[model samples]
Target: MGRARFAFGVLAFGYAFLYLPIAMVIVYSFNESRLVTVWSGFSFKWWQALFANEAMLQAAWLSLRIAFASATTAAVIGLAAGYALVRARRFPGRTLFGSLVVAPMVMPEVVMGISMLLLFVGSERLMGGPDRGFLTIAVAHITFSIAFVAIVVQARLTDFDRSLEEAAMDLGATPWVTFRTITLPLLLPAVGSGWLLAFTLSLDDLILTQFVAGAQSQTLPMRVYSSVRLGVDPQINVLATIVVSVAACALMLSGWLTRKKV
Candidate 1:
């Protein structure tokens, strides 16, 4: 009883510590005052201002496009890689390939960003290709996002019953048909989770995007960074509030889906 109570107390304290600043930010987003510290009264002017900011709006749109494309590509590639890694037996270099697939997850983001930038620059120089901009950023996002998707899918595959797949094959179904009918249905939840995870990561990324994005390819985080560096504004708070709300909704939907599946 004492240990359980102690664990609960620690968890509560940790949660409060992590969320207190977020709660404060959300509350103060409604403040009417220009100053972030002083709370005059509640107003919706900041929220309106956020919508009115043309640069921010453009950046948000670009970010949405990059996130959607990168996540979709990552989900497809990761699904295939994860399925192979988890199901294939006695294949050559399987161990090395699995490690390579997961390398991005453990690697430092700055190192990955710099490496990707160098790779793109070298490619451009050699091939005399067009400049790297949105395409480069999307590719970088997809590269890292695949690692996340693979991890999620691999977790789901760990507990899966392989015998079901074997049963499908034994019933005279072709390998492709067995995989399509039996394995894919069981992996749908993982696929959805991976897609959402990839999208969220791409949307939130700043370091890698900073390295890869061109002058005209500003993402929402890059825009926010520039704005906050100049000075703190009420519009930033409002933007933060909107982002948090959206993230919360996504998390809630993921949680509900997970529960339903269970």
Candidate 2:
């Protein structure tokens, strides 16, 4: 009983450590004070300001579009990579290939951002196309996001029963049909989780976005960072509240989907 109580206490403390600041941010989102540290009275003025700020609104919308596109593109490519890693066991470069697939997950974001920046700069010099903007940021995000999705899918596939695929094939189904009808449904939970992770990563990213984002393509986080650098505006609190709400919804939806699929 004592040990159980101690464990529960630790768990509660851990959760408080993680969420207390977030709770404070949510509560202060309505504060009338311009300073985040001070709470004057509750007001919706900040929400109005957030809506009125055209630059911030545009940045937020652009960020969402980039995140959605990056997550989807990453999911597709990562799914194929993971499938190959699992199914093609006898390939010559199988070991190197597997290592490369997961390398980004462990790599530093700063390193990745710099590397992608250099790649984009070189590509521009060579092709004189796809300039530093939405396309570049989305591609950079997809590069890192792919590793995360590949890891998730690979884990799910590792323990999956091959008999299901084999059984479908024996019933005169083609490889594509078997994968679409039988294999994909079982892998939906992992894929959805990966997509959600990729989306969240793309949305919350700052350093990587900074390296690739052009002047006209600033994202919400970049906007917020610039604003906070000048001063903590009440509108930033409102923006944080909105972003947190959206992220929470995505997480809950992913959980529901996973449970339903399982």
Candidate 3:
């Protein structure tokens, strides 16, 4: 009983530690006061203000578009890479290929951002194309997010039953047909999860965005960070609340789908 009590207490404490700040932000988002610290009363003025802020709205929309593109690209690339890693018997430079794919996942954001910046600059200098903006940011996001999707898909594939594929093949299904009819369906949950995770990572990323984002390509995080430098406002809290709510919903949906798949 004592050990159980201790475990419960620790769990409760950890939950509070993580969520209390988020809860406070949600609560303050409704505050009537312009000042975030003091709650004047419950009001929708801040939400109204947030909606009225055209720059913020534009940045949010741009971020969403980039996230969607990045997630989709990452999912496709990661799925192919995961399949290659799991199914291929032998390939040239396999170790180097895997390491390169995973390098962005573990590399520090500052280093990754700098490296991406240099690569973009060099590419532009050589090709005289692919300027830094929305497209570049989305590509950079894909580069980092692919590793996450690959890891998730690889984990799912590692323990998967191979006999299922063998049986399909024995039944005269071609490799492409079997994969399309069986493997893809089974891996959909992991693919969806990877997309959600990549979207969230790209949405929350500020350091890399700052490095690659041009004057016209500000994302939500960049906008919010710039606003906060002037001082914290209730409008920023409102934005934060909206972001938290959306992320929570996505995560919950992903978890439900994964559970259903299992």
- Every candidate's CA RMSD: 1.5, 1.5, 1.1
Lowest summed lDDT window (length 10), candidate 2: 253-262
Span of 10 residues, lowest total lDDT, candidate 1:
253-262
lDDT of 3 by residue, 43-125 (tens): 99999999999999999999999999999999999999888888885899999988987888999999989988998889889
Q: Residue 113: error of model 1 in Å? A: 0.9
126, model 2: CA deviation in Å?
1.5
Q: Which regions of candidate 1 deviate over 4 angstroms?
A: 1-5
Cα lDDT listed for each candidate: 0.89, 0.89, 0.91
Mark the regions of model 3 whose C-alpha exceeds 4 Å error after superposition: none
Q: Which candidate leads the pack in lDDT?
A: 3
What TM-score quantifies how close candidate 2 is to the native fold?
Answer: 0.95
Question: Positional deviation of 183 in candidate 2, in angstroms?
Answer: 1.0
- Over 1-262, each residue of candidate 2 has an lDDT whose tens digit, in order, gives 9999999999999999999998888888898887788889988888998899999889889999999999999999999888898888798988998888889888888998899899988988899978899999999899889998888888889988889899999999999999999999899888898999999999889999999886778998898898889976778878888888988898899888767855
